[model samples]
Each structure stands twice: as C-alpha cells, then as structure tokens.
Target: MSSTTPQASTTTDARRSFLSGFGKFTLSATAVALLAGRDRLALVGSAEAKTAGNDVTILNAALAAEQEAIAAYQVGATSGLLQKPVLDLAVQFQGHHKEHATALATTVKKLGGTPVAAKAKYTFPVEKLKTQADVLGFAAELERGAVSAYLGAIPILDDRELAKVAASILGDEAMHWAVLRQALGQPPVPSAFVS
Candidate 1:
C-alpha cells in the first residue's frame, strides 16, 4: 500500500513481532499451514514446542490489534461519510473484529494471562476521510493489513488448532479486504498472493 496509509506497515510489523514473542520456544515454519477451506488439518507434535506464557504475550498483542480494529470501524461507522449500505457493512465488520477480540481475550485468560485493555481513544486518519470513497479506501487498506498480519501468524503457530484459527481469521480478513476493495470499484483480489 501507499504511504497515505501507514497502518499497513505497522500492522505487518505488529504481526511479525509475534514471531519473536515465542521467546524460548519458537515454532517452525515448516510445521504447519492450516489455511481455511482445506480439509488437510492433521495433528502435529509441535504443540508442545510452545510455552503458554509466551503465547499469552503474543495473544495479548493480537488482542490489542483486534481492539484497535474495532475502534477503527467504530470511527468509520459514525463518521457520517458512509452511505447506509456502507454503514451497515462497517458495522458488520466491526462486530467481526469484536468477535476476534473476544476469542483472543478468552484464550489469554485460559492461558492464565491478563488480556490487554482497550484504550479510551485510538489514532486514525480522520481528516482524510472527507468522502465516502475515502473512508472505504481507508478501510480496505486496514483490511489488507489485517490479512497480512493473520497470514504471517499461520506458518509460525505451534498448535495445529491455533494455526487453523489463524488461517480462518486470515480468510475472514481477506474477504473483508476484498469486499472493501470491490466497494471502492477496485479489483477484489489484486494478485493471487495477499502480500
């Protein structure tokens, strides 16, 4: 993406940070690739390779990002720039982000870690959202970033179930990105690969 949206790089960097957060027990990229819509999910012995403590930290970071996505959607939903149909889509997408956050937070608690709290405010390019198309373009950029983030997590996930979850989330975010791009009169899928 262009510099008009800095969140793209930030989101990718944020997701990549989870790689190092593995700490003492890093996952092997060759161990898994649980993309959604595939029935090839098989049990892996690498589940034991990850420590729950480090998972909590990594999950917290993802939780924080999800919370921010929720907030970003809220901003767009109430910006008065989106039409009725677009507002409806924004609200629906926000709900998905909330669901994502819930899942991450629940997992964090299950792992005996405190989930990150949402900030009272978030930073967004509000001034650039002068038109409905601008808002949609901004949202598309964000969804693209989310797709990258979740896609980055898949191969490095130690647990097969977690890898599946990551891939499923990646698929959802990818669809959101595609829909947003389509709404903006752009190609839904610019390339075969997301990155």
Candidate 2:
C-alpha cells in the first residue's frame, strides 16, 4: 500500500467521546458547587431552579434582605452621621443580621439546598435619611421589615426547628425595632401599652 490513513469515522467517534466526558464533568462540578453553596451562579443560572419552591425561594429572599440590612447598618455606623450610641446599636443590629443569615444558611443546607448569595446591591427605603434621627428611623424600618418577614416565614417553614429559630430571630428583630424607635425619640413602649 502506498499510504495508510486513520479513518474519519474513528476520529469522529473520539470527538464524541471526549464531548460526552466533558459534559459529565461539567454536570458533576455543578452538582458539587450547588451542594457546597458556592454555585449561586449555577443555581441561578437556571431560572427554573430560582423559582422552584416557595419555602426555599423565601429563605433565599430573606437571606438577601437580611444581608442588605447588615450592609446598610455597617455603612451607617461608619458614616459619621450617627452618634456613638447609634453607631454602637447599628453594629449590634449588624451582628443580629449575620446571625440570622447564618441560621438561614444552615437550615437551607440541612434541607438539601444551597443558600443564595447576598445581593451585591440593595435599595434602602429612606429618602428622608439626612441626620442621626433619620438614620435611626431607617434602621427601625429595616427591623420592622425583618420582623414581619420572619413572622410570615414561621408558618410556612416545614421544619419545626427552623420555625423556632425564625421565632427567636423575630424576637431579636422586634427588640431592635423598639430600640431604634426609642433612640429616634419615640417611647420605649407604645403609648397605648403603658397608658
């Protein structure tokens, strides 16, 4: 024979095999990332995964909202618009937000889901926040939103332990709300409660 050449059919089969192996590897890597809670890109890569369930979606949403509060409080504490007392309290609220986020992530992991990442951007509802009073008012509103969201989640959570944790966090959020209101010159207790 003058010359011998590899069959085109063999080369095509090898290419297909390599592509199949790569597909499997990609799928495996994605699964591992989702399990490790590092695949928010992959988890949210599919809009279907993002809207899969009410409880899981709500937990993800709450994590985002709590993280927003934590970031806002941190900014307020360092912005010099707040007095030391307000700054200190803002730090405390930031701690609570972290705790809440940790608890939610733990629960989500235990339930065989990945915790959503905190959003890098958030919009605070405080067009009037210009002074210390305004900052405290903004904090109070954030806490109120957290408390209400937790209360709403309590009944929806299928896990009893998760519900209890939400209840505990709700109590802390309520306390933060009360403290913020007090610092903003409102009575510590509702006027109707004591009178």
Candidate 3:
C-alpha cells in the first residue's frame, strides 16, 4: 500500500509539470499571434507602411513648403512696395529659399521620391499689397509660418541627418522672421525662446 501511494504521488507530480510547461507554451504562442496580427493591421491601415516609414513623405512636404516660400518671395519682390534695400533683402531671401528648395528636391530624389514643382501662382493676398507696411507685414507672416513649419519638422523626422537639415533651415527661417519683424518696427528679439 505504501509503494502504491508513492507511485501515485510521482505520477501526479509528472502530470502537473507537463501541464505547467504546456500552459506556458500556449500563452507564449498566443502572445506572439496577437502581436503579429496587430502588426498586420497597422500595415494595412496606412500608406506609411507601404513606404516603409515617413522619411520620403516628410522630405517631399518640406520641399513643397520651400516652393511656396519661393513663390511668396517672388510676389513680394515684384510688388514694388518695398524700397531698394528691402527689395534687395527680399531677393536675397528668395535666393535662400531657392537654395533650400534645391537641396530638398535633391534629397527627395535621392530617397526615391518626386520633388513637388512650384505652382504657376500661389493664393496670397495680392490685393492687400497697396503699401510698404502691408507688404512687410505679409512677408513677416510668411517667414513666421516657414519658421513654424521647420521647427515642427525637426523633431518629427526619424533620421538624424534629416533632423539636422531641418534645424539648419529652422535657424535661417527664424532669422528671416526676426529681420522682417525688425523691418516692421517690431522688436527683433521678441522673446528669449522662439516658440
């Protein structure tokens, strides 16, 4: 009777060990299956997955913004409201924007994406360019918008190189905004930190 009792106990212990291992294996397989399903769903839900991420998308967006800035500066330069000095500055700023656009286009092409072309005309407040103040104000606002866009791009870019490029462009755009603000009789250094 004692031997029979030990045999029963050993059999119960072996059964428990096998069942415990099987339970763990089942849980692991289930977790893996769930994770795979989630990944598939994410892949099916967006074009981002099709592109293998947003690097090219981000670059193309930046390129488009640069094209818009170039067009805006062209309009401002031709408006005749700016004095000689201001017009020269606008031309210089426009050149800088062109350079940025070229760089962005090159990068986009290198990344296997198409660079966005400039539109024949952009929809700006052409009717409001009656005075120098209006022109300067519009230019300043456009610079501010460019600065904001580049600032926003810096952190969201996944590649460190692309982020650095964005930061460089951000600094230039911020400088342009500050100069425009100063020209508009506003303080050049409005705040210690640019938002």
Best by lDDT: 1
- Candidate with top TM-score is 1
Give Cα distance to truth, residue 35, candidate 3, Å.
36
Q: Cα lDDT of all candidates, in order? A: 0.69, 0.63, 0.68
How does residue 21 of candidate 3 score in lDDT? 36
- Residue-level lDDT of model 3, residues 1-195, one tens digit each, is 111121222245443643453344322233234334434424354554444247668877888888778667666666667888998898788767776776676566555567777665557767767788887888888888888888777777765666766777888888998998899899976888866
1-195 per-residue lDDT for model 2 (tens digits)? 222111211245443643453344322232234335533423453553443344576677788787677667755665467878667778667766776776666546644477987665555543455688877887887887887888777787654544666677777888898898888788755653210
Taking all chains together, each candidate's TM-score versus the true structure is 0.73, 0.67, 0.72
- Model 2, 57: alpha-carbon shift in Å? 2.7
Positional deviation of residue 95's Cα in model 3 after best superposition, in angstroms: 0.3
Instruction: Put down candidate 1 lDDT per residue, 83-107, tens digits, no spaces.
Output: 9888989878877777677777766
Cα RMSD for candidates in order: 11.2, 19.5, 29.2
